[model samples]
Target chain A: MTPQTDRRLQPRRFLLLTLFLAGALLFGLVAGHEWASPARLARAFANSGGHDMTSQLLVVWRLPRVLAAAMVGALLGVGGAIFQGVFRNPLAEPYLLGASGGAAIGATIALLVPLGLPGGPVLAALSFLGAWGATWLVLGAAGLQGRPDTAGLLLAGVAVAAMLGAVRSFLMLALSDDTVNLQVVLSWTLGGVQTPDAGGLAILALLTAGALAVSLPLARGLDLLGLGDDQAFAFGLDPARFERRAVLVGAAVVAAAVAFGGLVAFVGLIAPHIGRWLIGPRHRALLPASALIGAALVAVCDGVARAALPPAEIPLGLVTALIGGPFFLILLMRRLRA
Target chain B: MIAVDCASVSVGRKGTSLLRDISFRLNGAGFVGVLGPNGAGKSTLLRVLAGLRAPDAGEARWNGLATPRWPARKRAAFCGYLPQQFAPAWDYEAGDIIALGAGRASAGDASPGHVLARFGLTALARRRWSMLSGGERARVMLAATLATSPALVLADEPGASLDVRHKLDLLRRLRSASTSSLVVAVMHDLDLALRFCDRILLLEEGALVADCSPDDLLAGDALDRVFGLRLQKVRRHDDHDWVIGLG
Candidate 1:
C-alpha cells in the first residue's frame, strides 16, 4: 500500500473512531442528567463558584463522583480490551487475574480496622497494592516451574481469587453486626460511583492515560498475537515479553479503576467482546470503541440503578451482574455453536 | 538471500527432548521438504527455524545475525510463516486476514482485492474466516502469508486440507516461488514431497537420518528405513521419476 492512501485512510478512520466515542460520551453525559434537570445541574455548578461550604459540598460532593464514574468506566473498558486481546481469549477480563478479589480483600481489611482515616484514599491505595500484588503472585507462581503459561496463569488466578473471596467472606461475617460501618462497607462492595476527591480523580486520569499510551501502540502486535503464541513468535514478536507487558499494563489499569470505582463488573468482560463483534479484532479500533461502549454501558446502568426504584438507589454492581450474567450465557451459547 | 543455520540445536523441557541435537543449512533457492513420523519433532524443528521457539542448547542464525537479534517487525517483514492451522480470535474477513500479512505497511500493500483475486478468494474476501471451508481457508491463509513477499517462507503442513488439484497447484506455485524465494515446507505426502521438493530431509526419532536430493532420498534402502515402505521409482514421459510405494 502506498503511504499516501494510508495517510488518507488514517484520518478518516480516526475521525470515525472519534465520532463513535464522542457519540457514546455525549449519550453518557445526557443520561447522567436524566434525574437532575439542566437547571439543577447548572445551579449545582454555579453554587460551587465561591469556594464556600455550599461550593465545597457541590464540587467535592457531586461533580467528583460523576467524573469518577466516567473515568473508571472508561479505564475498565480499555483495560478489558487489552486483556482479552493479549490473552487471545474472548472471555478474559480485568478480574480474571484475581485483581478484583484482592482489591475486595484489601477493602475488607480497611473496613475491619478502625483506623479513623478517610476510607476513599485508604481504600484506593490498598486496592492498587492488592491488585498488582496478586498479579505479581500469579506471575511468580506460573514462572516457578517453567516459563509463563496462559492456562497456568488463569488457573492460578481462579484459585487465588477463590481463596481471597473465602477470606473476605470470613471477615464480613466477623463484622456482621456493625450496622453503620457495615452499610458503608456494603455500599462500596456493591459498587457505586461515589464521587471521588479531586485528588483521586486526577490520579486515576493520569494512570488511565498512561496505560492507554502504553497499550495502544501495541495494537498491531496484539492482532498478530491473536493468532496464537507460536504464530505470534514466528511473526517476530517475543511472546513472553509482550505477555508480561500486557499483564502489567492491564493489571495497573484495572487496579486504578477498581480502586476508584469499587467492583463494577461486566464492563470489562462484555465491552471488548461487544466491540469486537461490532468493529472486528483490530485492536487499534477495538480499544477506543470498547472504552466508549463500556463507559456508556456503565453510565446507563448507573442511571437505571439510581432511578429504577426512585428514592432507593440499587447497587450498580448488582445491576451490571444482572445484565452481564444473561449476556454472558448468550455469548457462550453462540460460541459453542460457532 | 535468506540462509537458515541451526547448529547443535535442542529443544524441550527438563529431560523430554522434542528436537534433539540437529543441524542443517539451506542457502540457495529450492524447496526443502521435512518428512518425519508423528513423534519425530518435524513441527518443532520448523518452529525453531521460523524463530517461534528458541533452542535450549544452540541458536538459529538468519544471515549470521542470530534469530533473536533482529527486531521482530523487521524479521517478520522478511520471513513469512504459515502454521498448520490459521484460526483467528474473531471472525475476521478473508480480506482483513490477508491485510495482517502486510504488517506495518499500509492496508494497500496487501490490496485485499489483488490477493483474493490471485488466490481465487475474491468471492470470499468479505466472508468471515469461520464461514470458509478448510480448503478455502487454507488458500486464503496461503495468500496472506505470500502477500508480504518475504525472501523466506516456512509453511507447516500447508497441504493438509487441500484437495488434489489445490495440492498440485500449490506445489506448482511453490516451485515457481523457488526461482526467487527460498521455500521450506513440512509435508506429509511422500509422493507430493518427491514430486515437488528439490531436497528432502528425512527425520527419525528427532534426528536427521537422511538429507539428500529428492531423487537420491527416494532410493529403496533409504525409503524402506525412513518411511518403512518398499518403493519403486519409475521414469515418466516428462523426465520425472514417479515414486510408487508398496506397503
Candidate 2:
C-alpha cells in the first residue's frame, strides 16, 4: 500500500479505537456506580447530587482509581504487545524479562527494612530501581555470553525470579506475624490499584505518557524485528541497540504501572494476543488495540471484584488470573493443534 | 563491483572455531555457490560476510574498507541476507514483509506493492505469510530480500523447500540478475548449483577444499573428495547436463 493510503487508514482506526475505549469506560463507570448502590445511584443521577460528599467520593476516589486502573493496564498491555512482537513469541509478557520479580523483591526489601523513610514513595522508588537493575543484569549477562540468546535470557530471568521469590518469602515470614502486616504484604502481592494520592498519580501519568511517546516511533522498528534478528539487521536495524532501547522503555512503562498499581497479571499476557487475533500483527494497530482492550478488561474486572461480594472485595489479581488462566489454556491448546 | 575482501577470518563461540583462517576476495558480479556438509560452517561464513556475526581473527572488507568498521546502516543498505529457516512469527502480509526490505527509504520511494508486482506476488500481496505453502513463502522471502536491490545478496539454502520448477526459476532469475549484482548462496542441490552458478566454493571440515569455476570444480576427483559422490555428468536433450549418482 502507498504511504498516503496507510495514513488515511490511520484516522479511521483511531476513531474506531476511541469509540471502543469510550464505550468501555462509560460501561465501567455506570456499572461501578450501579453496583456501589443501585437505589442511591438512580437518586443521585436524578437529583444532580449537588457537591455532596458522595459526589466527591465518586469523582475523586472512585473515578481516579478506575482511571488509574485503566492507565496502568494500558501501559502493561502495550508494553507486553511490544515485547511479544519484538521477541516473536506469543507467550512473552512484560514480566518475562524479570522486571516483576525484581520489583517484588525491591518492594519486599522496602517493607522488611526499617528505612526511616516514608512508606509509599520509598517503596515505589525501590521497586523501580529493582526492575531497572534486573533488566540491566539480564542485558549484561546476554552481552557477556557474546550473543544475546533469547533462551539464555529467559532462563536467567526464571533463575533470578526464583531467587527473588525465595528472598521475599523469607522476608514475609520474618517480619509479619501480625495479621494486618501480613494482609498488607499479601494484598500487595495479590495486585490492586492503590488509589494513589493526586500528586503521585499525576507523576505516574506523566511518566506513562512519556514512555508511550518514546515507544510509538518504535512501532515500525518492532515490525522489522518480528522478521527475526538477521532479517532486522539486514534491513538496517541495529538489533542489539534497538533491543536495549525497547527493553528499557518497556521496563520503565511496566515499572511505572507496578508502582501505582501493585502486581496486576494476565492483562499484559492476554491483551496483546487478543489484539493480534483481532487486528492482525501490525504493531501500529496492535499496540493501540491492546491498550484499549487491556484498560477495558482491567476496569471491568476491578469493578466486578469491588462489587462481587457486598462488603468483602476480591483481589484484582486473583480475579484476573481466574478469568485469564482458563482462557489462556484454551488458546494455547488451539495454537498447539494448529 | 560488490567486492568482499576477507583476510584470515575466523569465527567461533569459545575455544573451538567454526570457521578458521578463511580468506577470499570476491570482486565480480556472479553467482557463487558454497557447498559443504552439515557442520562445515557454510552458514557461519555467510553470517560473517553479511556482518551478522563478528569475525574473531580477521576482517571482511567492502570496497577495501572493513565491513564491521563501516557505518552499520550504510553497509546494510548495500547487502541483503537471508538466513536458514526464516519464518515470521506473526502473519504479516506479503507486501508488508517485502516493504521491510526497503529500509530507510522515505515513505515515498518504491511502495511494497511495486516490488510485490515485480516478483509476481501482486495477487498474493494481501495474503498472510502463515497461510502460504513453504514454496510460496520462500518466494515471498526472496521477494523481500530482492526488494532491497542490494549489490550483494547472501542466501542460505534458498531453494530448500522449493519444487523442481520453482527451483530452476529461482536459479535462472538469480543468474540472469547477476550481471549487476553478486548472489552468494549456500546450496545443497549440487546439480542445480553446477547448472546455474559461475563459481563454486567447496568446503569440508571448516576448510575450503576447492574454489574455482563450476567446470573445474565439478571434476571426478574434486566431487569425490568434497561431496563423497561418485557421479557421472550426462548430457540431456535440452542442452543441459545432469549429474547421475553411481553406487
- Candidate 2 achieves a global lDDT of 0.75
TM-scores of all predicted structures = 0.84, 0.88
lDDT string for model 1 (A84-193, tens) is 77667676666766777677677777777667999767876777677767766666665522223445666886787778778777888896676666766667667777
- Per-residue alpha-carbon lDDT of candidate 1 for residues B1-247, written as tens digits (9 for 90 to 100): 7788888899878778887789998897789999987888898988888887789988888887777787877788677888887667666777777767655334465566677777787787777776787777777777877776777888897768778887777778777877777888999988788888888888887888888898777664776777777877788898878778787
The i-RMS of every model, in angstroms, reads 3.0, 2.0
Candidate 1: regions farther than 4 A off = A1-34, A37-64, A106-126, A135-158, A169-185, A197-199, A336-338, B12-17, B104-125
Measured by TM-score, how close is model 1 to the native structure?
Answer: 0.84
lDDT of each residue in B16-110, candidate 2, tens digit only? 77887888889879899998888888988888888888898898888788877777667776887877788777778777888777654444444
- Candidate 2 lands at a TM-score of 0.88
For DockQ, the strongest prediction is 2
